[model samples]
Target chain A: MILQKISKQGKGELAFAGSLFLLGIFVAWDTSKMVIPQGSSIVSPQTFPYMVAAFTSLVGLVLISDVLRGRLGTPDGAEPGDPFIAPSYKTMAILMAAIGLHVILLEIAGYVVSATICFFGVSFAFGSRKYLKDFAVSLIFALTVYFSFTKGLNINLPAGFFEGVFGK
Target chain B: MGNSFSMLMDGFQTAFTPTNLMFGLLGTFLGTLVGVLPGIGPALAIGLLLPICLTVNPTSALIMFAAIYYGAMYGGSTTSILLNTPGESGSVITALEGNKMAKAGRAGAALATAAIGSFVAGTIATLLLAFGAPALADLALTIQPAGYLALIILAFATVGTLLGESRIRGLVALAVGLVIGLVGADLQSGALRLTFGNLNAIDGIETVTVIVAIFALGEALYLASRHTLVNVEVLTMSGKAWMTREDFKRSWKPWLRGTAIGFPLGVIPAGGSEVPTFLSYGVEKAISKNKDEFGKGAIEGVAGPEAANNANAAGVLVPMLALGLPTSATAAVVLVAFQSFNIQPGPMLFQTNPEIVWGLIASLFIGNTLLLVLNLPLIRFWVLLLKIPSHYLYAGITTFALLGAYALNNSTFDLQVALVVGFIGYLFRRFGVPITPLIIGVILGPLAELYFKRALQISQGDWHILIAGPFPKIIYSILLLVIIGPMVWNFKKKFANKK
Candidate 1:
């Protein structure tokens, strides 16, 4: 019965709202457990967090009720394209995975390797046909940025594997 | 007036130095480059460059940042005109008639009018900022913490209501941002709030990471997802760079009108450039001698919205410069830049660092003129930027996004934060939740809380002090109206419909 009710309404919006509400509750609960130092200030550090928690919970409730009342937001003027159509979940998953992989590999493998892999992965996910060309372009692009930041900008990018390669 | 003029002249002197001029030019160039590219705007562009700015001189870095801010405004109209894709929210209205103009093979005229209108409006708005900012700063000094709190509330109401499809969703996004903003250790009592026991969370989330994640990475994911579904055709330019005599005659008045409409609205916290551009388009259509040309490629249409768009960009600087209040997402990122430089931007900023403030104001004029020069003769070069394949473009952007995230504190954890935030940003985009309020909330939440607490402290925990005094009183009245006005209107409409 609950499943049917949720499915009848905007499922995604409801789930998001419910998650936010839960998050608000967690925040409030967590804030309540915090130990404030004696005579800290007229307004305790917990005060703002509690207010934020309350506001978040209130908004979450309002959103939930609104969604239940069939006031689900239409995506007109919010973005350029029609919002009713489902985006390509496969591509999204691929991109997300690529980003996750990049994050995991960044420090271990260094910027050049991880960035190239990420660039190539993203390009492939976007339907680029030429794998060889994409790989070459990604390598060049990553290296260029790496050198620019390291040499030109004086900012340190991780050179994890390259440290041994460059005999550093 | 003489003092202001002399100070502006001093500003020009600072801005006209060789290095500063180069920074201005470089900023305008990069700004246009990013603005012409789809899926990136000035905020991400600036965010990407924030790390680099840390290594440079503060004044020059600021000049370039300011240049990029207005420069992107000019370049955004190019994509809107040629590809029917708005590079930023402000340029969305330009796409409506601008794309039509491109299709009608008046792409040159449309581009020219947009460039010229931007130049005019930018100059006029900078003039306003130059003369008006100091006076406004002086006035802003009188505002107490309560008044400031009320002002922040007004900003929240305006930003929440004006952006997104529903105010509830906007507020929800804002609340989420506030929660995120509250994650670090509390400065007042030195207690951790939402760190989850992570050492990196001690400093909270970096603003650049959040911005780049939401604007760049999130946008790339959305674009990649929709890549197969949407096919955009870049319109080719076929005419001279200059607008015809007739086009010129029709465009000037609309340019003036757009500036007039956009500047005040920009100064106010009412949702940035979208409203003004649409307003300009409507006004132009109403007053146009050739009304039929509006939808089918009207020069007036291009001129008005483009002017409003640029004017609004300049207008956003007023509150940012004078009151240290960011009215838009880009301004919020700029606020981060200011904080990073250890320079607090508020009424005191003007008095403390007139050189940086005035120099930045002066650089806007220089950047505007340079943008006009670049856009007019180098139109074909910018058009060639469209020839880059989508796959490579997006791939490059993604790489930069990751690089930028990783570069922040050299911690892999920031990258992880970025990925998570990027996913949430994608969800926000997919669900039609506006990202602007989230950004505004994240940046402004802590500041608002500080002021709110200060106000209460001043009154020894009296809640009524929040609405005390004339300024806070006036602001609360407006806030009440803003919150209740729309509800009453909707209720009345529903009642009438039932009757």
Candidate 2:
């Protein structure tokens, strides 16, 4: 059983190594675009990025080596132990949609109105079936924040087009 | 001593104002409630409250937020003792002995001792802060880039100690966060580093956004993806929420010793609470007559570690307030909050804002009292929090987290960043990369780089200054040993085993 657990751990390390390699390649390619000036003792803008890229590449190679040596592995077992396991793809999809809608509507709907809608939808997505409880709480949270920030703290949170509604 | 007393009195006068008191109670109460929930602690609570703080009076809001900061540390111990869920990283030590006591049906004793021990340690640590903070500030005025660099190095070494099981993975996590933290516009040159042509990135990734993503949202994502959780049975109090006379007799020494050890260690930039907590536990175990009771269900183990953790938290403030050094992740966040208020927290802060500093220190005392009062009688009620279904709890967490991140800049780009970081955090967690180092790296990495450059500029490209003087030489020597000693020790052990 112990050996089995160790073996399972190895697979997870392999995937991490692959991800690190990809990240390294992207960083290296992105950083290589910078051209150094003719006469300056100062490091160029890309210097730090290139250094990080090189380090990342080295680490990635180390990780791949460890994986090859079967040192790293996956979690011991693949099983859902809790009733509230990983959220379903449907739930993630709904959450993503709600957030996207909120962002798109933020400028037009204004901070208060858009945030309220965002919270309400997200609350429902979380299986908060008590609509009244969710709405009341979400609105209080959003509006209290709005007044506190915009009025009390004097922060210039976007009032959006519906600034007329709150008279900001 | 006389001046310190007067300062305390003046501090109390400011702290005791009706508005400040109300804010303190509200902050502590909320802090405790949030801290009771697994994985949400003072740092997130403060981050969530930071935008709101921008709307309120800076001193009052900061006072309340600071109250919540330590208050959550106290509250975190409760959950660790009763539910084995460490509400914050510091409380993880508490769970080692605390949960054992709970399973042994001594949950009441464990909870009471932890609460009372935290109170004693917190109160004494406050006194230390009140008296020693000024002197420390005076000393910190002498700090140059050389000292600051050493301090950051010491702080970085904490990553190795706190990271579980695999130090290599922890270092990797720290490196990743440091790289990410450097992804915005350069401070000195005003040139962009790795924003990839995004205008919003010029302002840099908000510390709150990165923190909320990494610890709170990322934690949620990791737990979700894990598809597994320890289902501990909810422990109920079998008796009064007070320690027995015998229990008190045994616990008092450990509490005092822990306070003595933890307070000073916590003042050192590298001497984070975790080190002192372990040290306290070791001391208590070594000296206690009831050593066998440890790991089985020792009250002193819970009492000592919990006290040490709280004391160290209070001790962390000495450097943070006096020298602008953040000893822990929560301390780092608090440092960010101070910066956000345009109040640089260094030696000058004492001269410039005595009331604000003293009032905060005084409020820590009041907040601890309020927390003890709220928690002791309400122990049973808090246990009900453990019954909160994971689904509803995590859902609420996700909502607040998303809302909090959005409010940081009101930019959707941050929300997307949160989602991406959340996923990456989940992957990191799945791969066993500890997240605390990531937090340390993100917060400290930028500051270290800036300081390195600034100091170099001051000395005109003098690299020797980085390791100049007796103090800096000692720091480099220590750093060298820390980096190299482990590898050699491992090699020796392996060779010996082979033989």
Candidate 3:
């Protein structure tokens, strides 16, 4: 069981390296497709991208070898969060959903509504189980941001459903 | 020298006005508020402050932005000393001694030294900036495109090699950023490089979107998934907030030494505060009479690293203000702010817009003084910020991040772009790719390419032109040394160990 967990962790790291290698190939492939015009400045636009592609792909290979030798990368751990606590993927899923909902509802429902939903979902993901209280707090926070930013700071966050409620 | 002093006086007039002072005060206050938090960083704080540019005039906003920058630095030290959870590598050195002091019931003393050390370092560094910038700009005026290309190469090499946990990871981050930066059109040839046929891609991926997403949104999601259990404990102050005379005597020298070590590093393209702070700590530990007390609650340990951190922040401005080269993340953000105001911050800035240049520099000084006042005398009030629940804090960050990104252009596409970048940011955190090099690459990548092309254009396709100039030659040599220097040192140390 312990070995299985260790392998899972190693697999995650290897996948990260794989993604980086693929990204490099994509950059190189995409750069090759760009049509070079005649009499363009002494350097073609492809020069820097090619360098970047080679560097990324090469470093990605180095990382894979390092990981294979049991040299795992160190994540940023200098925060107040508990490192011992097993990360909750359920919470991650909820938060991802929250962000997606916020984006989709932003134009349809308005800044305050979408932000309130996002705020509430985020609070829930963070383990604030007081549902009614959380919703109230999220609503108030969203409304406060909407008024302060839209009226006070002149940033026109979309007022979709609540347009002209206060007669802007 | 005399001319700069007079220009600074003119700047004092602009910073001291009632409206600007209010904005400056607000900037520092908010800077500390967010910076004191463990997860949030100054880049995200600046993103949250973007809408203020729309509300106020450019000069006032610039003043506010400078104040916010200083405030965040001061606030970061506070968290290091109190919680021992450094938000960035720059504060990691401080956590070693300052947190020990806090645990030993010297929280107040630790906080005091950090505040006073920042003041001393900030004042001295600003004075140097006032005098040194014009001289550097004078020199920069003579540099060619090849020289600029060499300097940019030097920055890329140092940022890639010097920062984060591993050299390869840092370099990979930089390369990925270069790829992302090319997502727009080719400005010179008018050819689409990687836009995938979207016309809006002509203007390029929005930097504000990338910054807000990567730092705030990415951080928020990373925190949510990785951290569900609380582990922070803010130590209550047990003694007088003021440092004793003995503490003062021990601290003053380290402050000076730290300032001396930090400013030059900050002015150079290797611009992160992490190196200077570590060097300052090492110097203090090596020279201390209380060598046995090094790991324990030693005042010099706290004083030196904190001062180095501040002086290094100030040192970043020298390159930024003079040559329009951003040596650090804060400098990059400030350059973006200046660009937003349609004010180019190159050598011509002093000639074209003296009011804004001097005023911005002077306001930075005022902001430092304001930071000292806010953190030192009323520290008790600020310590309460640590009690804010992680959930609410991150939630607020997410809301503000999305708002800031959307507000920048009122475009939904940017929000989607932010979400995509945010996911990438989460993967980066999980895998340990440093964000700073990535940011530096994204913002400066296009500029580096432009300089490379121009230098080649000048020699009419002769690659040797890159090695022709004295400045380019010197800078390229430094780049070579930066890449090779550490490996040689490590190898020598390993050999000594084997012996």
Overall lDDT per candidate, in order of appearance: 0.83, 0.73, 0.83
Question: Candidate 2 or 3, higher DockQ?
Answer: 3
Best to worst by TM-score, what's the order? 1, 3, 2
TM-score of chain B of each: 0.95, 0.92, 0.95
DockQ of each: 0.62, 0.21, 0.56
For candidate 1, the docking band is medium
lDDT tens readout by residue for model 3, B121-144: 999998888898988998899999
TM per candidate comes to 0.95, 0.85, 0.94
Q: Cα deviation in Å at residue B298, candidate 3? A: 1.5
Worst 10 residues of 1 chain B by lDDT: B490-499
Clashing residue pairs in candidate 1 are none
Docking class of 2: incorrect
Candidate with more favorable, higher DockQ: 1 or 3: 1
lDDT of 2 by residue, B327-352 (tens): 77778788888888888888889889
Write the residue-wise lDDT of candidate 1 on B349-379 in tens digits: 9889989988988989899999988877877
Model 3 ranges with Cα > 4 A deviation: A1-6, A35-39, A78-87, B488-499
**Per-model TM-score of chain A alone?**
0.86, 0.69, 0.88
- Model 1, A13-107: lDDT tens digits are 78888888988999999899887766788888988899989999998899889878767765423333234555688998888888888999988
